[model samples]
Target: MLFLFFCPGSFGADTDEVFVMEGDSVSLTCLKKNQQDRIKWYYNDIRIAQMNGDPSKTCTDVQCNEGTERFRDRLKLDHLTGSLTITNIRDTDAGEYKLLITRGNSDSEKIFSVSVHDKVFVMEGDSVSLTGLKKNQQDRIKWYYNDIRIAQMNGDPSKTCTDVQCNEGTERFRDRLKLDHLTGSLTITNIRDTDAGEYKLLITRGNSDSEKIFSVSVTGVPAAEQDEVKRKTVKEGESVTLDLDVKRNPNDVMTWHFNDILIAEITEDQSQICTDFQCENGEERFRDRLELDHQTGSLTIMNTRNTDSGEYKLKINSISRRRRRSVSSEKRFDVTVTASGLSSGAVAGIVVVLLVSALTAVGVGVIYHRHRSPRKAVEEKQRASVESPNKEKEIFLQTQIEIT
Candidate 1:
């Protein structure tokens, strides 16, 4: 069990509230301990663990008569400090826990409240909805991002405010926030990298109140950083490959998204490669045209079409050597697929041939007019002379007959 001591808090005189994400381990500490002390841990008044100094005396869950089987083998007890640790915590584990320490008939109690929040992941420019409100519940809802109030709604007067309106002229969320009038669910549109943070929703009903926290993480780079993205142009029916530019690690998880939709993924030391509908629940737009390079994590799109033209984002999640933590980085490519399968040089050659053909036809028409005009004039002159000779003879015969 990997213990994350950061999620737990130190022992306090008052009730200590600890917040953690699901699937994490947390330790509720009881610092004040004595060798002869008898420590017992309970969840919502039900005894779950009891230890009497010795490590062998530690008993948990079914081993104790009053304990329940829900925890099973997931609990660990510290014999010296009397601190309780729970591993692989589920959402059902969120509740109040009490610790009773009996030191020679003097009983002391400590309280620890655990709350499990959800982790939400999204890409830039996508919209995310934070929904934890009960339907038709007439409660006042307030939303806070990074501990700053950004939106709120009241049921009595049906009043609501968001962003600047909630802060009396502050900016930040601005027009991106949408509050549901019925459920008070908040939706943020056109999410940016700066929008990634903790969001808390507080629901108040008379004297009782409840809260839900969501950790939002934006994966890809923001659209405003287009200069960092590589641009590629390919003719239809051609293939284009987007290179990762870095050597692939064995533990790296590579996912490719087109227009914010998952299209391909490579995982498990490159043993698992999926594309289109296989990667997620969506339209199979790629249709077996995608290929993954096992060595470099590069993506190749074969027989590209105009529909493939869009923003392609690659996210790589790998473990960092220095920090020993999972870190992710994104690379984007703006692909443009032309409808015509003609290269630029081929199109230029076609234009040159059409221009030469047009010039040749115009020159041939000018030459034909110049050559035919003189021949047409000579033929007309010959026909006029042939008719003039016959007319002169007829005139002379008519004059002689008149004189006689």
Candidate 2:
């Protein structure tokens, strides 16, 4: 027999938290059962912004000389639903935010907590541990790599696999992982270049759940002799050259891929440039612009356009005449090109405009969702609760009308 208990101050309210990539925009809504007369927002217990329904007035504390400088120009209010929109969010902007809505004779309060971290870098061949910081909660723990379950800790005492069992798990991390049952921490040993990606830990206690994310970046891979990231800024219509310092043999196959799409291939002692099995000179985008250095397998673009800025990868299959075997090597380069007349300020302005436009579009969609149907809102809420990474706690707000 199992029993579930709902604690005091936990009922009649819903708490939601969100994690976003750096520089991304986010929207936080204090969902209510009925429209309120006024909504006020607070950050870390300090009142920040307020919106009144009767006068149609919405202003931040900055407008009345009472708000902090942190949210001066980045916060906006959705008057209809009492949702808050944050733009160009940074790591420093992460913290606890509260919302207070005034109804006919009562005031309702809601809180939201946000946390942000860009990435975590670990050296290859070293070990790393991802921690979930709940001290007293004993529950089921599941760890995922790119959304695929890697390891799980079953709460059942009679179960065979209580802690870490990767043999039946994914092949990529079968023998290289360990999980701490008490702390809900996952440890990866002998980390390789392929293990550099996103990792998530989902913890479920009773009906409450929360998740933490870790973006692992493995370094110190010495397979190649070049920098992982090379920076080169060029003006529009200028020429650029990307080189692969691999010696090509007479029958070795050297291929160049642009943005993950195959562009050109060299075979027959580097004399032929073919798109596929057929021997051809150039493709639609390269035209007469590509020149190959046969000796070193270097590619030079004669006239570069703005569209040429992206990732350029090189793959070479070096055939060994003596051993009758081949060895393959891969290299990539990220290129960035700028217009000749655009200044730094102009570029920043363009980025801001694009982000603002994106936020506005998302706001319109949220408003449509709120006005369209309550059933839709409830459905979306359930979906969000199931999928939300930081949904370990649930807050239930008292509704004006009870659903029978």
Candidate 3:
């Protein structure tokens, strides 16, 4: 969490790469993003090519009858010049492609380029694969969870999606979790394991946040842990499963550190998982150690405590390329606690079942005056005031094991 690692040195630059085209072999590899023994290339401004050229020949060209006339078969350089390999592409050979550099030896132009993608398509099977990115129709499309932004239109009616999931503890299936209309989608009827997750579909046009990363692989069937605060054992009582696999995003702001100092800060813009055990912190001992299995974000720790060890984080937010905006994926869980715990024989068996039900209610009131049968002594005093042998031996077993 050193703020996404001392800031991720700018976010976009590979000679600014973005030359989507088609028609045949086109290799415009003139990369000098920041530095490289000099660079050069210009077409309409005439100059030909030269990016450390003449090492063994690597900038070739030949267009005889495709885009009108040309300078005839030319392939300059001997080593590795500015890069060029246009073989039979047309569309009048497009336009604008420059990169002239030189400041150490004085000759400059720095860098200035552009590319308008003309092809980008994909289609693949049974789950989902709808693609399209041109941007117009009012230019503003938002859909995320993988990069934070779950459907926003700017044409706000108070901006809704329940304002992006407002604290949903449980309802068994109240209206079954919605958001399928704006077409950003977040549906659920039955998809189990509490619906394994990692969904995305963010498409924004104005403020630019696009480079395609639309993923979706949910598989639900889990609930019970939004109210959290019920998975015991503190410093000595071992035993723990109380699942918890949680994730969150909004440019990332999640902090669930239990010992390194901090215990829960999932602003809930969206990112969930908690196969339930119990956890909370607006109060209480605040414990829900995280198990989020919406397809493995893995935070399972059942029986360990020096107060349950330390170091934990989830911090979010990211956008670099000099565009600046840090904090992205801050993970560092190192919890490890053990003193070989002990629960004092389960607290002396709950204090000998409350001192033998107070000596069996004073020997059933002196044997109910020696003759008994007062409705069998009031049904054994209401089963010893309701279950006490450690809550009647906790017998709840159901086995159907066939899991393949």
- Give all candidate RMSDs, comma-separated: 12.5, 41.8, 22.5
**Which of candidates 1 and 2 reaches a greater lDDT?**
1
The per-model lDDT (C-alpha) reads 0.78, 0.66, 0.40
Q: Report the C-alpha lDDT of model 1 over 1-404, residue by residue, as the tens digit.
A: 34433224444467877888867888887655889999999999999999985767679987877999988799998777888999987656778989888889788778888987666776686566777745456688889998888888886554578888775425887698888787677888778889999988899888888887778888775445544447888889899999856689978888889999988888874446788888766467888898888888899999999999999988776643432234355667899998875778899999999999999999999888777766665555566557797755665454444334
Which model, 2 or 3, shows the larger TM-score?
2
Candidate 2 per-residue lDDT over residues 188-221, each given as its tens digit: 7767889988887777778898666667788875
List residue ranges in candidate 2 displaced over 4 A: 1-19, 22-39, 42-48, 51-118, 154-168, 219-404
Task: Name the candidate, 1 or 2, with the larger TM-score value.
Answer: 1
- Per-residue alpha-carbon lDDT of model 3 for 1-404, expressed as tens digits? 00000112332333333333333434454333444455556655555555442344223333211122343443333234344554443333445545465537655442223332222121111122222333454444454433444344434545544224433223333443444333333333322332232334455666765433323343322233322312233343353433334443334344445544444444334443222222243323435533443332334554455765554443333322222222133334344455663478878998999999999999999777555445444554456548665433332111111111
Best by lDDT: 1
Residue pairs in steric clash, candidate 1? Answer: none
1 or 3: which has the higher lDDT?
1
lDDT of 2 at 325: 28
